[model samples]
Each structure stands twice: as structure tokens, then as C-alpha cells.
Target chain A: MDAMYQALLAPFIDFAFMQRALAGSLLLSLASCPVGVFLMVRRMSLTGDAMAHGILPGAAAGFLLFGLQIVPMTIGGLIAGMVVALGSGAVARFTVQKEDASMAAFYLISLAVGVLIVSLRGSSVDLMHVLFGTVLALNDAALTLIGLISVVTLVALAIFWRALVAECMDPLFLRSVSKLGTPVHFIFLALVVLNLVGGFQALGTLLSVGLMMLPAAAARFWTVRVEPMCLLATAIGMSSCVSGLLLSYHFSLPSGPAIILSAGVVYLASILIGSRGVLSTRNRPSRHRTA
Target chain B: MAEACITFSDLTLGYNNHPAVHHLTGTVAKGSLTAIVGANGSGKSTLMKGIVGVLKPISGKVAVKSGNRIAYLPQQSELDRSFPARVVDLVSLGLWPRRGLLGRYRPEDCDAVSRALVAVGLAGFEKRPIDTLSGGQLQRALFARVLVQDADLILLDEPFNAIDMKTLSDLIALIKRWHQESRTILVVAHDFDLVREHFPQALLLARQPVAWGDARKTLAPENLLRARQFHEAWDETAPWCGPDDAHSHHHDGEHHHHHDHAPDAIHKGAA
Candidate 1:
């Protein structure tokens, strides 16, 4: 039992950075995994992944302007993400390009611009830091930013819960009765961007959305309702974060990839063994009901 | 005539500046049950979208009477049934207009939802996820939502498409009940026989209005033929017709008489 405690709890208790990283990641997963569930339900998981890439340049610009400060990088990342998200949507609307195509174009450009910007003034180590993240290096400001953003996201989601669900199920019906649909959609997109920005500080731009989407996709096998799916995804995300942090501490693996890989494992397990999953369905008796 | 619930003043609606339904000018009277009949791609769906404010007008205006709430059901094909939501969750969205974004739902609202579900023969389906529902049950659930919406103007786009006979009859009965409640109801449908049997008024469309009046008169065999010809005559490169051309060709349809063809001509040709 003591050995298990040493393996599980010692690193977090012994090191301040580990505790900070765990706290920040926990808060982030709590907020973002639920948002990821919304993204999955709306068929926008790929869009979420694309927008995470889009956040890189703004964060890189912030790193350039203010070194590695959390506030500047967050603000810059948010601005860049919103620009790409809104700009891609506008481009899809006005031009002949579809949303997926425009998002792909914009995110690719953002990724290229971001890597170039980061590599201009800093070493390869700095580029790695920007791309893969350093959860172990989290400070007070980073922890606070993650915590605050998580709270704000949760509150906004609660307020817009009805509108969001209504929009997803039947957008035309929502629009005809009230003018809440478009604004609610924009607000939901902004929340997604905000969560990605908050998550990027710990998980990095590329892997942050993995935390958002993977657990959401995994949760699909466990439940068939939105609220439960959200709760289950958040729980799955938290577990991955904890296990990933421990794996990174003990096995000396990269934290971001470790976390995402843990989420992937959960997703795989869900597909195989979850109550409503593929394997379970395949194995169930094909008995007809006598009505 | 009853007061106008909706007015389209030379309304033209379409995508990318290409008119799908153009040169439409009419009033749907309050408490009127009107069937919008058209051939495939004849802008029946587009007209419904324009009325519900989904597709913006290209050149004209669609105005709903002030203080009249609108409830719209797009085609079933347009809905994502795979969405993770319970029947109760979908139906409760009807309270959005009454409750706004942040208002609390009173017990009476809950009761209203329950009553609506019962009315639609889905009394015990409150907790069932919408994804688990069969097509007919899903359609019934959607109807329950519309019932809870309690709107003054209800527009149903192809509501009967792919629906089984029993479900179709149940939904039709619901529409009839809504008509009895004096709601302005516009239905987009292809079954001319159903329209003639149930709806008092109809508008036959073919990108442009071919006829609009009594169901029997508007769906006259000659009008359906003209509608078909107009649909086929659509020129991709043609510019918007001038106002003089619009006035000359457009028909208010109430005065036009075809004394020769019998009304059952629809059962023979269109139905």
C-alpha cells in the first residue's frame, strides 16, 4: 500500500511543479472535456482539432513579444483562435469553399506561421516547449489562468445549455421561435476556443484538443445522452490527466503525448468493452422481443 | 378576409443570388390552413425557409404579424437524429420562447410538456434518448415539441414524408387540432389528394407562383401542367425578369377560372 502510495502520490506531494501541473490539468480537463462532448455531438470534433492548430501562431507571437508569460500567450492564442474560427466560417459562407476546406487551409497556415515564428528567436528546445508543452513547468499565473478559465467556461455552458441543445437538435426551429440560435452558436464556438487556449498552456496546441475530443469520442460508448456523456467524458479526461502525469513522472515520457495516449487507451477500451460499445453489441443475444 | 398572419411582398429567396423562389407576393391569412404544393425543386421548401427566416430574401420582404410567435419544423432529413438527447430534453426546448435563455420552467411548463407527449402518444418516452426512437416515434416526438411551442404560426416542411400511415394520420389529426385552435398553419406537401381533402387553401409553385387560392382551383390540372412547364422552362442564364414582366405573368389566382377540367384530375395525374 505504501509502495502504491509512493508510486501514485509521492511525485505530486514531493514536487511543487507536479502539483501545479496536476491542478492546472485537472481544472482544464473538467472544463474542456465537456466542451469536447458538445463538439462531438455537433459533429465538430475535427473542427475543434483544426482550431487548436489555429491557436498556435497567436501563442507563438505572444511568446515572441513577452517571453513565456502565461497571460500574454493566452490572450494571443485566444485572439488567433477566434480569428481562424470566425474567419474560416466567414470564408466558407462568402466564398465557394466549404467549411472543412477553409478550416484546413487556415489551420495549416496558422501551424506553419506558428512554427516559423517560434523558431525565429528561440532554440529548438523552445520550439518543442511551444509545440509539445511543459506541464511540469507550470507557475502560479498559469495555474490561476487555467482555474479561472475553467470556471468561466462552466458558467457559460450552464447559462447557454438550453440554447445549445436546441441549436444542435433543430436549428431552424430555434431560429424561427427566437433569435438565440446564431448568437448561441458563436458563444459556444468562443467557449471552445477559450478552452483550447487554456488547455494549450499545459497540453500544447497540437495535443490540447486531444484531451478535449478523445474522451468525448470515448464517452459515446458508455452512454446515449448528452448530460451523462459530458459527465463521463470529464471523468475519463481527469483520469487520463492523472495517469498521464504519473506516467510522465515515473517513466520519463513527454507529458502531453502521455496524456493524449492515455485518453486514446480509454477510447479504445470503451470501443471494446463499454456497455453500449461495438464488441458488446456484437456479442449480445439476437433474441426478438415478444410484444 | 381574416387579418394577415404573414405577408410576402414580391419575395425572392435563394442561395448565392440565384433565385429558387421568386416574384412571390401573397398573404397567409390568420387561422388559415394552406398547403404549399410544388414539383421537386419547385421551391416548396425554399418558401417555407423564407417564411421562417432561415433563408434571407434576395430582393423582397417576408413579414410576420407583430406579436405572433412562429414554430417551424424543417424536413425530417434536415434533423440529426444521432444527437444525444432524450425526448424530454428535445420537447423542453419548446419552453425557450416562453422562458428565454435563463428563465426557470414553472411546474405548469413541465405539465404542459407531459400533456403534449401524452397527446402525441409518447407518454412514457420522456426519458428515452431520441436516437433510440424509430422514425415514426421520432416524428411523434417532434410533433410533441411543436405542440409545446404553442406558436401562433406553425410551418411544417414535408412533415409527412416517409411517415407510416398511422403516424401520418395521428400527425394530420394534430394539425387539424391546431387548425381548430385558430393557428395559422402552412404545410409543404406533394400529395394533391391529401391537400384537397384537408387543406382549404393552397399555393402551387414552380420557382414562380403558378396558382394560389382554393385548393380545388389552385391545383387544377391546367395549373399543375403550367407549373411543370415553368419548372422545365427555367433558364440558368436568364436575368431577373423586370417588374413589368413580373406583374404581367404573376397570378393572384383567386379570380382565374378553369371551368372545363374536373377537380378529380389531380387523382388521375398528380397523386
Candidate 2:
């Protein structure tokens, strides 16, 4: 128990890595909260997942092509993520097919494409780092990059938030009321792509979206106001990151999974405790069924 | 001389290049209460959309008198009432156009929101999460948002849908008060009786407009036949049904919309 306390509490006193991860996570949570709020309202949480995993190919391409340069690889990954988002949005708008189906189709194709290219080239250790991430290798430069990306994302979100909400609530009405609907939608999609790319070094392709989604989902059970909900989501994300980091350190487990599992715990807990908690469903008012 | 609040000159409303409403002309007076009515696929919603600028007409001009802010309420089917927003939060969105980024609302804005809530008969629901409200209350909450906008040009699509009759009566009373306050209102209604009793004027539209003017004259039997025919949508050349899939469609048969730019064309027609 004492040793456990030391690992959880002592790390703050000495290790800069732990401090950086905590700070990074806090900042990241702040950044992602607004994004998550909109994603839930827009019913695009899964889309975030697609974008998160969708960047793998570009990351792989950059590393293999440039021999592991951070800038080239990140740039490739960003572009790839955006392409997947924009393409999916366009396809859904134009076709009769559902957006979720389109997203899944693209996600699998992107992963397969990345894998195929990596295997065919026989030179992909750098690519794996991008795909699975290198949380332990989150040196000062990586932290700095993550911090900058998070700051940029939050600032943009703060400015465009009202328009974003209006658009999400009613695109047809919002388009009529404001002339910026198209711009707002594209800007939001771009932000999602950027955040997924920013978390690439720490969260990896498979896990980054979980952090984005689960904390926000957990926070939804607590409030209806956008501002409060967003703030709570950020706090949840930060706490998940800290606890996951501590648990990861103590157990020598993968930091990403620890964080995701922590977030999942919160989500399940909220679901159980929300008005229709598992045992309370019979007594609860039935949810209004939407067409 | 001042221009009419809205003016449509040889306007065509459509989604793609095709037009659902072709060669349409009209105008709306300031402080007028206008009703738009038609059958399913009659392009009633499309016309409202066109007026508000949600959809762009292919080859028509819809011009609005400048500097007139607008408050719009879309069809109920389009909104997700399950969101966590409260009645206050939903209404406050109306104030967004007034405040710039980083601009906080002054006390007066808050007062306006309160007044709007009261107007919609949602006086005590300032902090009520949207989900707690019944269908009628939800409509009222949305209407409160429009009041917060306090805009001179108010456009509502299917405002009375999914509500009990008492709530519909309450909404009509609220709309009447707004009209008395000198705001021009364009309401899309599915029920024929609501428009005849409350509005002095109406535009009966199908794939194209069958008639426009005093509600009694516009809803006359001969025009009603045209409205039904236009609504049944036998013709492809109408400007309201634009060739593109995303642009024009019918919802509850009372409005026409062009996908790219509905506002400009609608004002022209409204005028």
C-alpha cells in the first residue's frame, strides 16, 4: 500500500515524464471537450473514431518515405485523416448510403492499405511507432507538439462554437439563419482530423478516439447545458489520463489502454447511475423514441 | 421609395439546376403575417427554405431589404430534442448573431431571453433541460429562441406539428402578438384551418405556386385544384423540384426550398 502510494503520489515530486503526461492530458482534455460535445450532438462520435484510425496510412507513408522524420510523417498523417473525413462527408451527402457505413468502409480500407504498403516495403519500424504510438517516448518535443495542437483546436472551437451548435441543431435552419454553415462544418471536420493527428504519438491509431469519445459520453449523463457538459468532459478526460498514467506506471502496462479503460469505467458508471440506472429502468420514464 | 421587405422577380427555386418553382414573382409587406400551405411534395417547405436562403434557386433572384435580421425555426423533424440543452440555452442561440466571438451578452440580452421565454409560455423553464419538456413545450422553447433573436423577419416551418391542440392555440396567440409588434412572419402550416383563421394572406404552393394574396382568395377552390396538381408533382420542369437530390423536396406540403440559396429567392417571392 505504501509502495502503491509512492508510485501514484511520489511521481509528481520527481519525474518530469509523469508531470508532462499529466499536464499534456489535462490540456488535451480541455481541447477535446468542445470537440466531443459537438460530436455527440451531431451524432458523429463514431466518425471521430474513423478519423482517428484513418490517419494510419499517412503516418506510415511519411515514416517509410522520409526514413522517420517527425514533420513529414505528421504532415502525411494529418492529410490522410482529413482526406478520410472530407471524403466520407462528401460520400454520405451525395449517396443514399448511411454515414456510419461509409465511415466503416473507409476505416477498414485505410488500415488495410497502410498494412499492405508496410508489408510490401519490408521497412516499417517507424511506421509501427505511428500506428501503435510511442507514449513512453513522449519526450519534450512530442509534448510541445501536442500542447500546440490542443491550444489551436480549443481556440478555434471557442470562436466558432455558437455557429457550430446552431448548425448541429438544425443544418437547414442554420444555413438559412447564418451564411457560415458550410465553413463551420468543414472547420469542425478539420479540427477532428488535427486532434487525431496530434494524439498520434501518445494514443496510437486504435486508441486515440476512445479518449475522445468515452470521457464525453460519461459527461453526458451529468448535464444538459453545453458549457457545463464540455467542462465536465474535460475534467473527466484529465482525470482519466492521470489515473491511467499512475496505473500504467505501477503495473508496467500500456499507458494508452490504461487511459481508455479508465474512461470506459466512467462511461459505464454514468450509464448505470443516470436516471435509468440498470436496476431502475422499470420504474423510470421510458425514453422518447425518435423516428 | 422603400422596397418591399421581400421581392421575387422571375425567380426559380430548385436544388440542382432544375427548378421546382419556375418564373415565380411575389412580395411581402413589413409586419405582415403570411401563410404557406400545400400538400405533400407541393414544395411548401421548399419555398420557406428558398426564402430563408437554405437552398439556392437555379435561375431566379430573391432579394430582401437589407439590414433586416431574421429568426428561423426549421421543421421539428430536423432537431434532436434528446440533446442536453436547456430552454434558456436553446433560446440564447438567438442572441448569437448579435454578439461577436468572445462577446458576452449584456443584462439586456438576458432580459430579452426571459421575455421570450415568458412569451412562449415557458416562463418557469429557464433552467429546464430540453428533454424534460413535452412536444408542445419543445416547440415553445424553440419559439422562445426566435423571440430572443427578436428579429423583424420570422420564418417558421411546421411550427404546430407534434403538439397538442392547446399548445397550437397558444402558439398562434404568441404569433399574433409578434405580428402586432410589427414583425413580418412567414409560417408553414399543414392544416388548412390554421392559416385561414389566423393569417390575412397566404401562398399556396405545389411544385410551383398556384396562388398568392389574401388567404381567402388564395385558398379558393380553383387555386386549391392547382395547388393539388402542383403538389402531386407531375411536371419535372418546375423550378421548385430542382434536378439535384440534395436541393429540393416536399415535407408536409407547405413550402418550397432550393438547396444552395433559399433566402434570396424566398424574399423575392415573399415580397
Candidate 3:
């Protein structure tokens, strides 16, 4: 028991940085996994990824201008992410192209520009830090920011729960009864951007969206209702965040990928063994009953 | 005449500057049941959208009586059936017009949702995820939502297509009940015999007003044929035509030759 405790709980108990990392990631998972559930149901998981990539250039630019200050980098990322989200939406509305296509095109440009900006001034190590993140190096400000974002997200989600679900499931019906659909959609997008910005501090722009999407996707196989799916996703995310940090500490693995890979394992297992998963139902035939 | 619930004055609704519904002038009376009848893509759906304020008129006005609540059940295709929601959750959304955003779902409201589900033959199915339900069951659940909405103006677009006979009869009975309650209701229906048997009023369209009023007369064989011909003869690339140009455009041989019978070609004062 002591040995297992040493392997599982010692790092966080022994080191201040590990505690901070655990706290920061747990807060992030609390907010983002719920948002990710909505995105998965709305079939906008790719849009979430694109928005994450879209933040790269602005974060890199902030790093360029202010040399790694969280405030400047966050502001830059938020602005870039909003631009990509809103700009692609506007283009899709005005032009003949669909939102997914427009988003795809814009995110590619943003990703390329972000890489170019980072490479122009920084050494490879600096570039690595920006791209892969520094979960172990989170300071007081980063943790505070993640905590604030989590609080705001949970509150906003509580308020917007009905309208957001209605909009996602049956937009035309919502529009007919009330005029809240468009504004609610904009607010949801803003929340997504806020969470992505919060996530980038720990997971990096490239990997931040993984934390948002992977557990949510996995949760879908286990539950049939939105609330349960969201709760399950959060559980999966918290477990991954905790275990990933431990694995990183013990095995010398990069924390962000380790966390995401942990989620990947959950997703894979769910795909095989979840209630509605492939292996669970395979080779089983049941007699049909009348309603 | 009864007080007009919805007044459309030369209303032209469209997408991308191309009119899907053109130059409609009519009034749907208060406390009346009207069936919007047309061929496929003949603007039956568009007119329903316009009345519910989903589609803005490009040329004219659609004046729905002020302060009236609307409950609309669009075709099932418009809903994301795979969404992770139960029948109870969906039906409860009908309370939105009453409870609104951030309002508590009171015990009474929960009772109302339960009653609606029962009314629509879905009492025990409340906990079932919507995706697990059959299409007909989904439609019944949608109707249960409309019941919970208790709106003054209700619009149902092709609500009965592919529905079984029992579901159809149950829904028609619900519509009749709503009509008796004096709600302004419009249904888009494909079956002419059903519309004639149930609805008192009808509006026929072939991207323009073909006829309006008296279901039996409006859906007469001659009128349906005209709607079909007008729908088939449409030029997909034709530009938007104003009221003045619409008459002449139908006469212009370069666009289409069959519409030259000018007197029969226009229903200038028919509604």
C-alpha cells in the first residue's frame, strides 16, 4: 500500500509544482470537458481543434512582444481564437461555403502563420515550450486564471443550459418560439474561446483541445443523455489529468501528451467495452418486442 | 371577417435573392385551421416559415398579431435526432415560453410535461433517449412539446408524412382539440383528401398564391393542376421579379411558353 501510494500520490504531496499542476489541470477539466460534450454533440469537435490551432499565432506573437507573460499571451490567444471562430462563421453565412469548410481554410492559415511567427525569433527550445506547453512550470497567475475561467464557465453553462441544448438539437424550433438562438450561439462560441485560451497555458495550443475533446468523445459511448455524458466526461478528464501527471513525474514523459494519451486510452476502451460500444453488443442478438 | 391572425400583403419570401414564395396576399383568420397545400418545393413550407417569422419577406409584409406566442414543429429532418436528450427533456422545453431562460421548472410544470407525454401516447417513454425512439414516436414527442407550449399560434410543417394511421389520427384529434380551443393553427399537409376532410381553410401555392379559402374549393382538381404546372415550369435561374414585372415575366416566351394564358395566369385578387 505504501509503495503504491509512493507511486500514485507521492509526487503531488512532495512537490509544490506538482500540486499546482494538478490543481490547474483539474480546474481546466472541470470547465472544458462540459463544453467539449456540447461540441461533440453539435458535431463541432473539428471546429474546437481549429480554434485551438487558430490561437497559436496570437500566443506566439504575445511571446514575441512580451516574452512569455501570461496576461499578454492569453489576450493574444483569445483575440486570435475569436477572430477565427467569428470570422469563419461570418464567411460561411455571407458566402456559399459551409462553416466547416471555412473554418478549415482559416485554421490552416492561422496555424501556418503561428508557426512562422514562433520560428522567426525563438530558439528551438522556446518553440518547444510554446508548442508542447509547460504544465510543470505553472505559476500563481496561470493557476488563478484557470480557476477564474472554470468558475465563469460553470456559471455561464448553468444559465445557458436550456437554450444551448435547444439550439443544438432543434435550432429551427428554438428560432420560431424566441429570438435567443443567435445570441446564445455567439455566447457559446465565446465560452469555447475562453476555455481554449485557459487550456493553452498548460496543454499548449496544439494539445489543449485534446483535453477538451477526447474524454467527451469517450463519454458518448457510455451515456445517452447530455447531462450524464458531460458528468462522465468530467470524471474521465479528472482521472486522466491526475494519472497523466503521475506518469510524467515517474516516467519522464511530456505531461500534455501523457494526459491526452491517457484520455485516448479511455476513449479506446470505451469504444470496445462501453454499454453501446462495439464489443459489448457484437455477436449478441435479441428478440424484438412489441411496443 | 374574423380578426386576422396573420396578414400577408404581397409577401415575397426567398433565399439568395431568389423568391421561393412570391407575391402572396392573404389573411389567415383568428381561431381557424388552415392547410397550406402545394407540390414539392411549391412554397408551402416557405409560407409556414414566413408566418412564424423564420423567413423575412423580401418584398412585402407578414404581420402576425402582436404579443402572440408561437409553437412550431418543423419537419423531423430539422431536428438532430441523435442528440442526447430524453422525451421528457424535449417536452419540457415547451415551458420555455412561460418559464423563459433561468426560470425554475416548477412542480406544476413537471406535471404539465408528464401530462403532455401521456396525451401524445408517450407516458412510459419519458425516460427513453430520443435517438432510441422510432420516427413516429419522435413526432408524437414533438407534438407533446407543442401541447406543453400552449401557444396561441401553432404551425406544423408536413407533420404527418410517413406517420402511421394511429399516430396520424391521434395528431389530427389533437389539432381538432386545439382548433376547438380557438388557437390559430396552420398545417402543411400533402394528402389532399385528408386536408379536405379535416381542415376548414386551405392556401394553395406554386411559389405564388394559386388559391386561398374553402379547403374543398381551393384544393379542387383544376387548382392542384395549375399549382403543379406552375411548379414544373419555373426557371431555376430566373431573376427576382417585382409585382409589376411578375405578370409580364410569365407572358415572356423567352422564359417559358405555357404560361401565356394571361387571365388564368394571374390570381390578382383571389385571396
Residue B234, model 2: lDDT of 48
The list of candidate 3 runs beyond 4 A from truth reads: A283-291, B231-240, B243-271
A106: Cα error in model 3, Å: 1.1
**Model 3 Cα lDDT, one tens digit per residue, A1-291:** 999989998899999999999999999999999999999998999889889889899998999999978989999998988888888877875689988999999889999999999988889888788778889999999999999999999999999999999899888888887789888887888888999999989998778899999999999999889999999999999999999999999999999999999999999999999998998679476775684
List DockQ for all candidates: 0.59, 0.45, 0.71
User: How does model 2 do on interface RMSD, in angstroms?
Assistant: 2.2
- Candidate 1 vs candidate 2: which has greater lDDT? 1
lDDT of 1 by residue, B1-271 (tens): 4778887777888876667887776677899998999888889889888888877898778899998988888884456778887899888988877998889999999999999999999999999988889988988988898899899999998999888999899999999999999999999999999999999888888887777778998898988888887644456788766666555544444324221222222112111
Q: Could you give the C-alpha RMSD of every candidate to the true structure, in order shown?
A: 4.8, 6.4, 4.3
Instruction: Name the candidate, 1 or 2, with the larger TM-score value.
Output: 1
CAPRI-style grade of the A/B interface in model 3 = medium
Candidate 2 lDDT over residue span A113-201, tens digit each: 77766675645565556666766667777788788989899889878887887777666656656677777888998898887777776
Candidate numbers sorted by DockQ from highest down: 3, 1, 2
Which candidate number would show the highest lDDT if scored against the true structure?
A: 3
Model 3 vs truth, CA RMSD: 4.3
